[model samples]
Target: CLEPGTLPEPQLVASFLDLNAPVLARACLLLECAFFVNRCNRGEWPSWMKMNLPLPMQQAEHLTQASSQHIAISISGPAGANSDPID
Candidate 1:
């Protein structure tokens, strides 16, 4: 999967949400997160990071946790956080 290239950006994720398509938004966000985590695992940041297997292992687990939390929050809707904005 680490095919020596630039990271892919989730171009229309915001647009998906703007159009009231949360399922699409979540899918797009998940993809973005996946790509990001994969890149981190592959250490594809040019001269910034070297490949490390341990980092890859941790990143995989973190992605699962992060994806679930983000999806759960999105499914619950914006009414909860938008109303509070602080806590």
Candidate 2:
């Protein structure tokens, strides 16, 4: 029962990783990419990403939708910039 837009506590996040490492890892990677794009758009970079680590690089828009049952996250790359209707 995870809520959308709200980050879980560190302990919970760790437990989730332990419970579903592969799936959570992939989701985390996507989140990191989204954060990176957001930071780039803001014209500020921390040392880690700016140093050129082997991280996935892509310009994307992160969209979130909330319903009763679940939160839907939609990520669109540069090619699909206009695909998301909920600006």
Candidate 3:
């Protein structure tokens, strides 16, 4: 269920609606205001209601470096071509 004052105003609503969440199933969502209100009152919002909701999360540089290292290794090949790009 959504807490009181949880949902932002219509302008903020426009922002979320503009997001690209097509990978997250969309058909299941319906614009039923009464149902949403009742579910919020009863604390019964579906788990995925908030799934994929946007928030700031930091990216890890270590993973980036590691993947780059692997690519370097693969591109080096048996001859160890360190100067070559991933061609």
Question: Which prediction has the highest lDDT against the true structure?
Answer: 1
Model 2 bad stretches (over 4 Å) = 1-21, 47-87
Candidate 1 has an lDDT of: 0.64
| lDDT (Cα, tens digit) per residue for candidate 2, span 13-72 | 557655656886758745765675677678666664467644343222112223312422
Per-residue lDDT of 7 in model 1: 40
Cα-based lDDT for every prediction: 0.64, 0.52, 0.56
* Candidate 3 structure, TM-score to reference: 0.23
Cα deviation at 19, candidate 2, in Å, is 17
Per-residue CA lDDT of model 3 for 1-87, tens digit only, reads 554324435564555556676634222232344456677688776556666454444235656778999998887786565456676
Candidate scoring better on lDDT of 1 and 3? 1
* Clashes found in each candidate (C-alpha, N, C closer than 3 A): 0, 0, 1
Stretches of candidate 1 exceeding 4 Å from the true structure? 1-21, 46-87
